[model samples]
Target: MEKKKISIDKSACIGCGCCAGTYPEDIAIGADGLAESVTGVAEEDVASVCPVGAISVEE
Candidate 1:
């Protein structure tokens, strides 16, 4: 199976740090105060972490 990549919608993000707090290994807070994919990959089910649905997993 192919690995899924995590995508962060900057416009939709509120910089709540929920995703980063939950998945510190794969997600982080960027300089812009928005959620960013650390390795452009998803090691866990993190799409549901965002309260605004800013995080998404892509195949």
Candidate 2:
């Protein structure tokens, strides 16, 4: 089985938190106000909802 992972590009993130709102279980805004992956498989959803294209997935 593959382990799913998600990451955010801090530089590209606009801190919209849309990814967080879309997938609260897996994404959230860090102290710096950047989108962060908390847990579970959120890569695909984050990448799709992020308007700035700041999210990426590692399988």
Candidate 3:
């Protein structure tokens, strides 16, 4: 299976903590108050909790 890459559209991010809570190991709240990935973590749980749809998984 192809490795999925996670992407966050900062402009579309509403500063929600859902992604951060869901994927603490990879997702975090950046200084800009947006959801950011520490690395290219592919987590379906994080994407599912994103309300503004700022998270995307590329495979």
Candidate 4:
């Protein structure tokens, strides 16, 4: 298995917090009101849940 990385585009984030809600362990809402990837493997569910297309996974 390979490690996965999640990255959020702050400019594209809409502060909806949906990504955080979808993956609490891997994402969080920062003080800037944007969803941030904290830790854990990046899943498709998280990217799919982002309303603003801000989340992406790195293989």
lDDT, candidate 3, 1-59, per-residue tens: 23367899999999978888877878899999998888787565557788888898875
Error of 3 at 40 (Å): 1.2
Q: Point out the worst 10-residue segment of candidate 4 by lDDT.
A: 39-48
* By TM-score: ranked, best first: 3, 1, 4, 2
Instruction: Please give the lDDT score at residue 48 for candidate 2.
Output: 76
Ten-residue stretch with the least lDDT total in model 1: 41-50
- Highest-scoring model, lDDT: 1
C-alpha local distance difference test of each model: 0.83, 0.78, 0.81, 0.77
For residues 1-59, what per-residue lDDT tens digits would candidate 4 score against the true structure? 34367778899999998878877877889998887778856675567787778777765
Relative to the true structure, candidate 2 reaches a TM of: 0.78
Model 3 regions more than 4 Å off: 1-3
User: Candidate 1, after superposition: displacement of residue 35 in Å?
Assistant: 0.8
Error of 1 at 36 (Å): 0.8
With candidate 2 superimposed using the best TM-score fit, by how many Å does residue 47's alpha carbon deviate from the native? 0.6
Q: List the residue pairs that clash in candidate 4.
A: none
Model 1 segments more than 4 A misplaced: 1-3
For model 3, the run of ten residues with the poorest summed lDDT: 39-48
